[model samples]
Target: MAVEKFETSLKKLEEVVKKLEGGELSLEDSLKAFEEGVRQAAFCNKKLNEAEQRVEMLLKQKDGSFGKVPFRLDDE
Candidate 1:
């Protein structure tokens, strides 16, 4: 599947998991699905991180004003 968007990629990953669980595919096909699933999962994770950063940059400060702040994962 050509994963053009995060939602599409996530849905593809779910389908891969279902196919793998069904135990109908051969070893080589199963391996291919697993690899694709890994790629899709990484893509979804990266998109989520980007969205979180955007939200963090728009956070309201203590002074009741919005400001762009560098988002640091370690701060969590």
Candidate 2:
């Protein structure tokens, strides 16, 4: 299967949320949209996890003098 970019999946998930919240779809259509939203959420989560792992790996000391440090947002 082909992977969607994180930004695309996130946008799709947001749209699904808006549709569900708007309460305009039939039960069947709502169910389908909910299912798609779940899928997009999972894909986005997976991509975020992969990125976090990469960041951790990159932060490790090059000369083996230090271990990997946890990543934190600068604003946090």
Candidate 3:
């Protein structure tokens, strides 16, 4: 799939895992599915990491109060 949203990528990753566990695909097909799954997993991990950074920033505000804070990922 092309650049999917985080939820969509996670759902596709789950589907990929199910297909691999079912053991019905040929070796080549299984490898392809595994590669897709890896991509999705990496996307999800990056998203989660960005979110964690945002939360940490919010918690570290100088006023010692938890509140919404604007965030920008370094690479963005």
Checking candidate 2 for backbone clashes, the offending pairs are none
lDDT string, candidate 2, 1-76, tens digits: 2355888999999999999999999999999999999999999988877743445434547776767665678897
Which segments of candidate 2 are over 4 A away from where they belong? 1-4, 52-76
Q: Over the stretch 1-76, how does candidate 3's per-residue lDDT look in tens digits? A: 3445888989999999999999999999999999999999999998877644333345556877686667677997
Estimate, for each residue in 6-73, the C-alpha lDDT of model 1 and write its tens digit.
Answer: 88988999999999999999999999999999998999998777643253457788999997767667
Q: TM-scores of the models, in the given order? A: 0.63, 0.63, 0.63
Candidate 2, residue 41: how far the Cα is off, in Å:
0.2
Per lDDT, what order, best first? 1, 2, 3
Query: Model 2 misses residue 33 by how many Å?
Result: 0.4
lDDT of 3 at 29: 100
lDDT of 3 at 35: 98
On the 0 to 100 scale, the lDDT of residue 36 in model 2 is 99
Better of 1 and 3 by lDDT: 1
Decoy 3 TM-score against native: 0.63
Candidate 2 CA-lDDT value: 0.85
Candidate 1 residue pairs in clash (backbone atoms < 3 Å): none
RMSD of each: 7.5, 7.3, 9.5
